[model samples]
Target: MPRSIATLLFLSVLAGATPVLAQPGGTPMQLPRTISVPGSGSVTGTPDKAQVRLTVQKTNPSMEKARAEAVVVVQRFLALTKKLGIPEAKVRTTSAMVNPEYRWDQPTSRQVLVGYSVQREFEVEVNDLDKLGALVEGAVDAGVNHVAPPVLDSTKRRELNRQALAAAARDAEANARAIADTLGVKLGSLRELTAGGAEPPRPPMPMAMMKATMAEAADAGGAATYTPGSLTFDATVNASFDIVSP
Candidate 1:
């Protein structure tokens, strides 16, 4: 109907004057009563693994020369990893691209083709944190010109998740009981349990180590230094508990 009538109806419902529809037998249908609560928990541990993405880029007037130079740089990086005793399985080339370089020319009022650029990117997974700094230094020394910030990881991620989930479950139960006690009602059997909203922890938190820029890596002279920090895993759970008269 009109807005005024709709508003009045809603206000009346809030005032506990809602109209109830009768069933086929003329009895009113009642909805099941439940209380849903949200809970969250977290656990922290040290990171024991890391990954680094390294890239080699070359640009030249000739596409052939650019491609050849990029290949040589990539080979050097791979050979260095091999010498370091890193397993072949943990290393893989991620991407390779060849594009024509263009420059905006003010005199010609048009884009001018300058050269060809060839780039190759690869990733290395390091199980030993002690070797992380050395690995990055070695790659840069081998002429790998670009280095992305390292991503620190934990070997016990599954265990941590389980612990966090347990904590979250307990938290949810506690919340339900507290609400029930406040409402002067008893909490009956669990109607539903849903786990969601938990995500893998991101980097740059306190004590977490993300490396410096490519220039900083090259200037370190010796093996680059890194401070492995603690990582926190979190979990959230939504629980529905039946409401019963006390």
Candidate 2:
């Protein structure tokens, strides 16, 4: 058909049928009755555990000399933990790396091998939060040259998650009911539900005890103060429900 004839026929057909209701702005819209709601809940508690990373590095002219010194230092670190009453099961070597040190030789305009560096890292889960500050100080004094800021944790994670989830569910149900009342409808069977959230917020929110622990930390004259701060764990849930006649 010609463009003009096709346009005329389309208008004629629309005129023959009853126009379904349009949303504001004359945009045609249709849908089955359903409501979706988003809800979130949180529970707060004190952190009772700490996760810490400790590192020892050694550089020497010979690769064997550097590696041997690194191993001895790591053993002393493990021994310190045992002396502190921290169980051996809680500590493990996380990474070991040996890299060749390079120097720019301006005369030759090429990189030259200067030495070998051996680095070892360990991950420790300390169950006793009270001893966290002391542990960091002791570990640093013992041979740890690098320490990532300790990550505070709790033993009651499962309990907190359950509480947060329950609160989220109740929150979702309340929202559904409120919408149903507004629309003069009864909230019917749940069509779908989903719950999700991070275990702990990434780059965990700063707690009171967090401190800068660079190589200079070991040289500090006094032990650093540690404060285990309280944190709230949150959970989010999305729910969909059928809207039935009241």
Candidate 3:
């Protein structure tokens, strides 16, 4: 081939290679600046009702005797709650168990059957806070040995949750505005929003000593005093908004 022809061919190949080298880089593109923020809100309200776990336990030399005694104690407890004006629907049996007691003989390496113990538990719901202490005391007098502290709750929890969620939204909006100001950008309309479900209300710790004193007062026929503690509803929200340059 002639030298000029060969030179022209080489130049054509070089031109084609230049466009391939100019192709875009494989790295990811840069995105706009954005911020994520979380906000929390809470609302407090008085509990309307409360529930307690009460148990009657009895042990005797004979299984039959233990079962009978347990039944009597449970009956007395139910009667006492009824006398206190607690509705039957509000009081119900939760558990009943009869188990045999075992005694281990070290010398013989054998298990000896002693007797049976019977246990019965009831759940009680109280609408009046003032009567809470009295109710526990009354049951204790009626033979309840194991009594769990009362769990307080608001019957209108749905309403309380709604209020808390509204408050959380407002809080989230305020937080977004503050962030936008700090960034020297104008706050734009909300682009995305997410809400966490409300948490269940927590009950106050039951004072065992206080409960014993209340029981003693009830046994003496003296009025027992009780103050219902308030509960708080908490909610959280996550919101995103478009960021506009100033």
Candidate 4:
């Protein structure tokens, strides 16, 4: 988050007098008198949606057994999501693989094969923010051992971003007007404009919070409590206004 916010003004001519340059054939060309400014805006709103990543891992002396156990856990997770009314498209398998586990023996000075490990990762998107805590709890109870921090988001991100941009444009115009007045010049029509796209807000999720949430889920059995914080989208714009009179 930024500590301060202000529009920076850049004036083409500080004295309100346009500079003249000699062109070919001894023709004099006057530079355009304008006020350019950069402006920023931010919009904050509550998140109505969330996404979480879960992984199921299993290890056994036999490679086949480890792989089979992981598959079963994954199947259970999928069934749970389906039962919770989550669309199949929203629940996707990100990765699935099996690898050999090894341990080093100090006395023998060699690596020993301990077992085989199998892991599968899944990403689930939940539209109902209220169901996020329950979904995470259910996944954990269903043998999902690795869970990433849930990402909070809004469904109206696109519209909010546009609103932020509009605010930024207005700020730029206000800055140009102020600078023009200070220079004793009358503002004219807009000469040029450039828009910078809005930036997506990143929700703050500390590791301690995640751990505490999981612990509470294990103890409570029911849906865990969750708070969907607000998200802020920031946008910037650069605008130039022509100098009509001085």
Candidate 5:
């Protein structure tokens, strides 16, 4: 090859390799400088709805009779709920079972089938929190001996979630700025951002049976008042920012 052709080939190779050494000092090139961190945020809200769980149990010599009695009790509960202005769509039967009671025979080493027992459970949602106490008392009066204390919640959870996400974004930005200040650098344009998935609302702790009994006693003396508790919502976010040296 001629000398001029060989020199031209060498220059082309050197030019191709120069980009590997070109870095941020020359101009604003994308170089990883910032660290990402997760920030958590939360908000509290008042409950506007309530849910109640109730069970009906009956025993009889025959399975059919036990099941029939359970049905009657459930029907009565439905009627009572309707009278209390609870919509039928909000009340539903969650479980029903009929099983034979068994007696263990030690001598024969066998299990004997005795009378049958039937159980029915229902889930009821109440939009009116003011009537919660009356609803419980009405169920008890209607022969529902196994009624769980109602769970209170807000119907406007979507709005609460929105607010929580906004707060979380603000928290993430603040955290990023604090980190940048500590490192003695300026926070540049956002590189990446992601939001944590929304979690299901946590259920409140059940009030103890003793507390309910006491509340009932208080009700007998005069009008009883219940203080509906607040609910908390949480959000999380991960953010990355470009770091610029001062």
Candidate 6:
């Protein structure tokens, strides 16, 4: 359930200008006459999709038994999703792992094999937010031991990023003109533009929020009340303009 979010990485632009030093032949190097500025923009809106992550873990004295038990739980969870009308395309197994359990043998001063554990994880996209709370409860009741905090996402991600990028480009142009005005020079045409990564990353779940949600689930038969919140997207750009004479 770990989400990868870019940390609002903005374009790094040259503040003003720097004189080119000596060339290889000890001759004066000519520097490109240009204006470079860094700019940023952001948009906030609700997400259209919810990602639900849950896990099933089983332990037994033998590896075969552990794997078989885990398979049963996983099947039950998948069946629950189908019963709840979750599209097959929206349900997937993210990972499956097996681990050998060990116990400290104080008498022999060594570690000894005790049992085997098997764990399986699933990622389900719940399109209907109204059913999110009940979905969580249903999955947990069907032998799911781990439930990650739901993640909200947008279907119009590309469009929103386009808007942010446009805003950032305008910001850059505005700042460039401001500098040209202060320097008593005429604003010129854009010579080059470069930028990328317009998605604003989010922080990890807070302990307080986790505690509150767990308490709610405990009180409501493993079903916690959830509210899908808005997400903020940001974009940045770097622009270089050719200096012109009025």
lDDT of 5 by residue, 1-246 (tens): 668645644443333221122346775333345547677788889888888899999999899898888888888888888887998899988998888899999999999888998998899988987767667766776788597767767887888877888888888889988876765567778788898846537564356752564477566863234567787888888988766544
Residue-level lDDT tens digits of model 3 in 1-246: 668755644453333221112226665343333445687888888897888888899999799999999988888888888788999999988898999999999999999999998988889898987788778777777888887878889988888888888899999889988877765666777778899965667675467655766867768879666666788999999987766544
Scored against the true structure, residue 74 in model 3 reaches a CA lDDT of 85
Could you estimate the TM-score for every candidate? 0.79, 0.76, 0.82, 0.88, 0.79, 0.77
Model 1 is weakest, by summed lDDT over 10 consecutive residues, at 205-214
lDDT of each model, Cα atoms only?
Answer: 0.79, 0.76, 0.77, 0.82, 0.74, 0.76
Tens digit of lDDT per residue, candidate 1, span 1-246? 668755754454334343344579999854445768988888998998988888899999999999999888888888888887889999998998999999999998999999999999898998987777777777777888877777888989989888899889889999999987776667889999998646557463222243453246557555666777788999999998877643
Clash pairs (backbone) in predicted model 3: none
- Whose TM-score is higher: candidate 3's or candidate 4's? 4
Candidate 2, superposed: residue stretches over 4 Å from native? 1-32, 202-223
Model 5 misplaced stretches (Cα beyond 4 Å): 1-30, 197-201, 209-225
User: Comparing candidate 1 with candidate 6, which one achieves the higher lDDT?
Assistant: 1
Global lDDT of model 3: 0.77
The best candidate in terms of lDDT: 4
lDDT of candidate 4 over 17-64, digit per residue (tens): 665656899998876777789988889888888889888999999999
**Which clashing pairs does model 5 show?**
none
In terms of lDDT, model 5 sits at: 0.74
lDDT of 6: 0.76
**What is the Cα-based lDDT of residue 72 in candidate 2?**
85
Q: Distance from true position, residue 168, model 3, in Å?
A: 1.5
